[model samples]
Target: MKFNKKIFNLSAWITLLIAYVLPYQSQSSDGHSTYLGYPLSFLTINNTPIYKTLFMTESIDIFTLTIDILIVYFVMHFANVYLSKVKLNKGMNKTKDFK
Candidate 1:
């Protein structure tokens, strides 16, 4: 099997989103405590993170992040597919004007 640009770009995008999406420290309590009472599991299925912040197990984060990530992948692919085809239409119109 081979890895490709799509894999890296999507992974990088999610990684950045998580790193930045973490609720701001200003919103958190005093920067010393996690909003949640426990370390969060990145894979938390529900609103558990609404309470803790110790950092959940990587296993959990992985499982939870997967579904969201696959959705992102499909969305990007769909958008690009339409955009690419649209560009061809644009060129056809431009050529028609010249003729």
Candidate 2:
């Protein structure tokens, strides 16, 4: 089968959107907090009470992001393969009936 750039692009964008949209927040006893998403952490906030001060930080977990992308890609690939096979089988059955 030929490669379709549009499908690839669309899947990649969707995967990224899902990865970023779903986030889990966790806070520690020491006033450290983190926002973890599927395969990566999106934000980290640290609170230090040194004369009333708050610090916020945000970073992307490259490792997890990479893993997330790979996982999504594989899932999409398998789904595409399964769908194509189903379509091909349907087409073949139609041809057999006509013959």
Candidate 3:
């Protein structure tokens, strides 16, 4: 199979969008919080001991975001490759039947 740049780019963007919309969220009663997203977090709510009952804070975790992006990208790539192979096989089978 040949590598397609368009497919690669499309998968990258799709994975990013998915990561952006769906992030890993966590909340703890101990005043610790986490909201990790791909590339950047849209919103984060952190609770400190003092502000735990009052309000929350916001921040980004680059390490987790990078890992999340990588994971989603690989999964998307695998699905894309698998689907393309299935499609190619179907086409080949159709041609064989015609012959």
For this target, which candidate reaches the highest TM-score against the unseen true structure? Answer: 2
Q: Write the per-residue lDDT of candidate 3 for residues 14-79, one digit (tens) a residue.
A: 655765477655554564666645544534566566644533466545565556555666666688
What TM-score should be assigned to candidate 2?
0.65
**Cα lDDT of model 2 by residue, 1-99, tens digit:** 556566667666765676547765666566465565555554445554566544424456667666665666666777898998999999999999988
lDDT of each: 0.49, 0.64, 0.62
Residue-level lDDT tens digits of model 1 in 1-99: 234468548754764376435632223333433321111223322224555543541124455355555555566667777897899999999999999
Pick by lDDT: which candidate is best?
2
Model 3 stretches astray by more than 4 angstroms? 1-25, 32-44, 47-56
Model 2's alpha-carbon lDDT is 0.64
Error of 3 at 39 (Å): 14
Q: Order of candidates by lDDT, top first? A: 2, 3, 1
Which pairs clash in model 2?
none
Error of 2 at 16 (Å): 3.2
Task: Please list the residue runs of candidate 2 whose C-alpha ends up more than 4 Å from where it truly belongs after superposition.
Answer: 1-8, 28-31, 39-56
